[model samples]
Target: MTGDTMRGAARAVLVGPWSARTWQACAHLLAGFPLGLLTCFTVVLLGGVTTGLLVTFAPALVTLAALLWCVRGYTALQRDRFATLLGVVIDPPAHCREEPGRVRRLLAEAAEPGTWRQFCYHLLAGPLGVVGFVVTTVLWTVSTMCALVSCYAWALPADSAFGRHLHTPSMVIELTVGGLLVFHLAPFVTVGLAAADTWLARTLLGPTDIDRLRSQLVSVTQSRNAVLAAADAERSRIERDLHDGTQQRLTALAINLGIARQTLPDLSGPAREVIEQAHEETKQVIAELRGFVRGLHPAVLSDRGLDAALSGVVARSPVRVRLSVDVSERPSPTVESVAYFVVSEALTNISKHAEVGAAEVTVARNGATLRLVIADAGRGGADEGGGTGLRGLTHRVASVGGSFRCDSPVGGGTTIEVELPCES
Candidate 1:
């Protein structure tokens, strides 16, 4: 073997004998014993009382509710202990929303499956704890006594039970060897027991699989909403900066150029022609900037609401658009913005891909939902997975708890529909 390989082996042997994890596992096992026994006694007592009171229906219901509540608290304490000692953290299930009355809320909590799972865990923990505690205590005690046998060997009389067979040299060798083996093996045994306890706690005390999935779904939904909200805020900020800062300065420059063009001498030559061209170019730039600002987020959308904003969209479409709005009250700005983009993109696609001259755009509010439908009398074969713009619009609608759908048959008309919740 190489010199490096020998040194590495020596280091491994030294490190293996002094791992902190071994002590932690031993401590965890020791703590579980008392906790498990206490939990077991409490669960049994409460369960028995609750069952016995079942003869009186109302009392039984009340007692059972209280017992379940205690079990939840106990499980939470155990979960914390497991995290502190073993570094295993399990997520608890979401609490049920409270109903109107106190009794209803209590009953709701009692009906949860997690509450019963906790009870089951407490029921089984007592025996497991006893077994772990006994095995760990016996192993450590025997190992320590054997390791120190040399110190006490001379004190015992020759006729005594242990002294009769004790040959100091041979006894020391045997006891020392046994002690070394047990000392090294104890950590593995304790760790195994700790792993078992952790498994039981996670299986019964932690959230169920369905609950975990539901939690993940809720988290995803919230994150999506946050992203959409941030994007919308950023768009609004950019639009404001352009309109209030850049657009204003551009408008002032165009006005100044026009004034300079008219005030310059009527030379009727190259110099006069240059001034007029500069003025016209400035005017053209101002118009393009206006269009860009509108595309970012139209001021009309904020000032006049979806009705007028969508009217602007229809007016700008290359093809003629039949438009209608039936909203009794204005929806939120976010809903209106998404609706406008949906229409704008749809019309853009229609003018580019659809071989028709005109399309219909409809917007309506029914109860708490805002509905938008854009239909075109053109040859249609729109596919969401075919890398069409409709797929992006679908995601946009879904980001705000909305649904998007498209129906288009080859050589037939295409229809795109979206429904957004506009609850105030």
Candidate 2:
């Protein structure tokens, strides 16, 4: 390649984007300095006066609130700037929920970590901004003046100190060298200052890793709750459809067979026998349909609450069951459903796998939590991974923010305990 083309390519590669970025960084820091100074002054004045008045007057809390609010606004601006200029993504801290009473709410807001972080940011901004502004401004000013030194060389008189000692060619060469040094170094210096500002912004203006994780956890929890609600609604719909549509049809078929059996003559012999057999079969089918419908979502559970619903489950258990349910208030349908299923599954497992003659089922509601415990006096080595039923129960309980624990040692009686939150 030619010399000029090679030099142009080098300049583009080394100085093009970096130089633009450096200028942008310098502008950002210089703009932030005045804003930071204003914030520092305002915060200090308000803080000092508020601290002095807090001993006697309750109204001084308002001043503190206003100061914190302003600090948050300033921090938000910094975060936005960082994202825009430096391409650093930062999330604002989660907002605190307001308490019932005004004073309590104010205290809660003031105690938030984000509020203090912002306060610290505002306090440090003035000094940090000053440093960045000075460094960047000096570098750019010196670099530009050196780069344009040839343009102003004529203004220096030959009798002056610089002109008298240095010949024209020597002066030009020295000026050119100095210009190249400053011009090349300016972008790096600007970038260094900008990096410092970015570090401060990220540390003070953005939420910490723990805060981000907590936010993600909350979002996941909300999504889980939504999914559980949808599932419950679908279950209810299916139960309704079975009860009103298929179950009703089966009941009507049974009734019709009963009527035909009654109407048929005894003298019909073989035909009479066939009608009787069909009648019996239809009745059995109807009974089976009722069981399936109840299994999907029991009508008693919805009508009479968890106590009566569990009673039905215990009654149906093949093994002897000692049932004790003490619940004064009816919990939400979702919680009740989870509790019922947990007990039902535990009992079924005990009947099939535990080889136990007797089991104990206890369900009680303590404040906002519904606790269900099922124990079987049988050889117990139950594992959740051993069966789909237990794993399914675990998922169901977790969906509603409930906990399911199984303690079944080898040769020891099995115990399944569940705690379900009743909050809607």
The clash number for model 2 is 0
TM-score of each: 0.72, 0.85
lDDT (10s digit) by residue, model 2, range 1-424? 9999999877854683356687677777887788778778878888887898888676588788878778878877877777777676677766777799977887888888877877888888888778877877777677667667677777756555644533376775776678677777767677777787777777777778887798889899778778777887788789899889988887888888788888756547888788788889888987887778777788889889888888898888898999999999888888888888888888888899998799999999999999999998789888889973788989888888889998989999888899999884
Best by lDDT: 1
lDDT of each: 0.83, 0.81
Find the number of clashing residue pairs for candidate 1: 0
Cα lDDT tens digits, model 1, 132-169, are 88988988888777777788877755454655556457
User: In candidate 1, which residue ranges exceed 4 Å CA deviation?
Assistant: 1-20, 47-65, 87-116, 142-184, 207-224, 252-284, 302-305, 315-336, 352-357, 364-371, 382-404, 419-424
